[model samples]
Target chain A: MNLVIVLLIIGLLMIVAGCWCLMRTFHLLKMTIGIEVAMKAVTLFLVLAGRISGKIALSETFVITVMVAEVIVAVVGTGTAVGLFRKYGSMDVRNLKQLKG
Target chain B: MTILSICAHGFIYGPILVVLIYNLFNHEFARKHFFWFAGTGAVWQILAAIGGFTALNQNGQTSYAFGAFWDIRLAGAAFFELNATRFLLLLIVGLVALISVLVAHQTVDFNRSSYTNLLMILVLGMNGMLLVTDLFSLYVFLEVTGLCCFIMIAMFRSRADLEGSFKYLILSELSGIFILTAIAFLMMKTGSLRYADLAGLGQRISAGSGQLEDLLVYAALILLISGFAIKTGVVPFHSWLPDAYQSADTAVSILLSGAVNKVAGVYGLMIVMQLFGDVAPVGPSLAAVGIISIIIGALLAVRQPQYKRVVAYSSVSQMGYILLALSTGTTLGLVAALAHILSHTAFKSTLFTNAAALQEQTGTLELKDLGGLENQMPVTAFTSIIAFLSTAGIPPTAGFWSKILIILALWQAGSPVLAGVALVAGILSSAYLIRLQRTVFFGQTRPELAKVREVRGSVLTAEVLLTVITLGLGLLYPYILLLLHAGGIL
Candidate 1:
């Protein structure tokens, strides 16, 4: 039953990732958030795979540390998005035409 | 001997400490601090050479391990190895830092104390990168250097600098994320992040069923390489180089082109290749990218009107040669790559400083506005010629030896066609370089440049120092080769 749920989540995440990859007209902030959702789902998928395989989650400490790092990275990414919006008046990476070569 | 060497090792940390004390005391000690950093760097380089020689003489044997308080592991493992190669890399870091400071004293007009401090921190991080054997430690040092690069470039606070720095930071962040993801995968599979620990994992992955292991390793490699490539400004990822180099003040470009790119990008690629010997499978892929960089970079460089942008694009091409040699993985290839690295450092910095002097004196770097610099700034023009010749790979110059060695290595590796391509690239190098010389130094004086006079002593000293090294390498080719071999890079 749990396996079915995990697979469903992964399938949904893949669909979203494809959509994000194709959305060329969206704001950069939105696209970046989409990437974030996909990444998080992938991590969840890893946890589910380990659980399904019955592999012992060795060292809860390491797992906690990784979780913390993931959260920090996500926060940093959001901050970067905000900064980009402020600088260019839009978060669309396509608008960064000053350096296009 | 161990105690003495260990103390000497700690002395490499002296530059940072000096800066810290000076700042706290509000002392006007830029010159003193500069000398302190240079002196300590010289001392460290001498120590590293001695240690490296002794290790080689002893048939590659050395053992020393001090306390490491911040050993964060990906999967609960510790990696601490001291080797001769690490010592040589440390020596390179020290030498480059020392050279940068000497060059800085002449050309840089920014806040002296802060610049020296940041430079020391960057040097410290680079030294740490060379010393650490663990993957996590590698990442830590990588972040340190990357942050330093961002801060240094954005230090000017110009709109162009900010935009360029922002772009660089974002790209680097993306790459960093991928690297972390790869590290996570490795930890999940092998339960350890120590490089030696990964050796067993590598074997298991290699011998495993299907190409899953191959895909995973390549994914990690791709992430790391892409990140470092962005740092180094290799082609297809070189948009940041010209903007950053052109907009930056003089000292920043010198460090960016000469040191930052090498440490943060090329160093990472070399480390990954050395760690995993299975790079042969992807060797062709790397070679393809390198060839494209060589062709595109040189062609684009010829079309740039700005002097600095031309040098910037040429760096992209020169670094491609470095990447190509690494891809070959032959002894001769490795030797040539290292030789090129050293020679490029000398000549490229000379070019940058001389270009800066021209910019300052004439208030422009546009080739259309410059002419007959040889008669007015004889010293600058002379050094510029030597640097240009060295980079053009003229015979009996350092660049020539390195290029020939790389070609020989490619031939040894059974890629005569690639070697021929490399030769063609060499001709392209000569074409663009000759054009630069004719336009800047040999032509009749431009009306606008009539008021230009030679820059004074210190700037001239810096260029002369670097140009001397560029010329000396050719005359001392055999000894340099021996040094490379002894350095365990060959």
Candidate 2:
């Protein structure tokens, strides 16, 4: 129980740190990394839930599935980043102003 | 083994089959006849949904559960379930996909095969979301739908397309993280994320176990609401919506506004309402979000210079109506929300189809660049008027009936103030849509647009088909009400 509480705090701090990185960064690649860090924290939370509930097997399956989905999201995010770079000649998100109302 | 079961299975497998067959063919041939493959699949889905709905109703079963290959008797196994609500959503999915394919036939010039592939996968994903009985699978399928949408938006690889897809991807992923974290929290308390396990969670929370458990539940509620709110593009979290809509291809925009937002966002909220509705804060929070979105979305729409952007903002406003209805947390409220969903799909897709027409004919969707197209494009002009009327809740249109039901539901749910506020918001809807209609279709033809003519072929067909649906549904609404009254659902 003590370990669970400690891990929960660490996981939450990681998520907050990741989101801060996302908000403070203009680099597209950095944003994707931030998202990845936060997603990893979510996976940790899932594992913690499983541990506390004694449903480790179910949560393990969920963690594996989430990892697969996260990787796909990362790949797609990078692919879009590459597309943006080729078009704008930079990875800065500031260039994404073409569609504003 | 049963026909209804086969139809249920078809929702999952049919799109996969379409994707398989689409890729199996050589590129040139497949590109040439992409519509036939995609169109047939959509029509089959429509028929199967209707058939399943009738069969389910006839058997007097509220929900039917089936598995693809797994045994149903096993403990803790995940499976698909279908009921009236899921069937209605499935039917809407098919209808919107068909409309999108029709519009794409006119607009999506390059990368036709890939468009078909991503579209079928999107359908598969939405179908998966609707069919799943567990929250975790729903999240997985929601991500699948979001991924497909991002790829489809960036399919052309233009600068604006990539920008829009990237914005949507980031925010959508953020929402995903929030949802996943909430699921973890909920699971910690309940030991499972299945709908069956979480059905009466509100009572359990109120029954008051430990302090930590209640705290976790409250925290999960907040996360879940915010996560889905981003997807729904409710006012505060709505920045990514118009940009994504305005930047994507019109066919994809039609899919986004007409189907994806509702399924991925509004439908998720519907699940939340069903499970956690008895929780005290859930209702008020949803109501607050709904009202804010309605007012602010209209105010924003009033200023958008682009055609699709206005419609996109209008989507934000309309989503508020659905959420408001859901917030009431009554059977009537759910019915009202479902009715609004159907009517919104009809009119919103009609509006987007008109956007496709205007874009194809006039070469731009800038409201200032367009004028006096009424004389030249009679069908498009007429359909646009009908859609506008429906959108503004004018009489003899589907939007009018749905909005009326929404207000009625709210009033009966004892929030007459919210109901009155909703009633007045119709004027705001009318304010912007009327501005749109007068600016683009009602004024004198600009010199450049003088040569514009009515868009023909599949786009025109989509326009007429959607207009007919709006009018028919509106005219039939009274009978629908009567039937509902007879069935004691009113």
- For model 1, how does the per-residue alpha-carbon lDDT over B107-155 read when each residue is reduced to its tens digit? 5565566676677777777766766666766766776776676667666
**Which residue pairs show backbone clashes in model 1?**
none
What lDDT tens digits, residue by residue, belong to model 2 across residues A1-101? 67877888899999998899889999999999999999889999999999988999999999999999999999999999999999989999888889878
When summed lDDT is taken over every stretch of 10 residues in candidate 2 chain B, the lowest stretch is B205-214
Query: In DockQ terms, which candidate is top?
Result: 2
lDDT of 1: 0.68
> Ten-residue segment with the worst summed lDDT in candidate 1 chain B?
B65-74
Interface RMSD of 2: 0.6
The second chain of candidate 1 has a TM-score of 0.89
* Strongest candidate by TM-score: 2
Docking quality of model 2: it rates as high
| Local distance difference test scores for all models | 0.68, 0.93
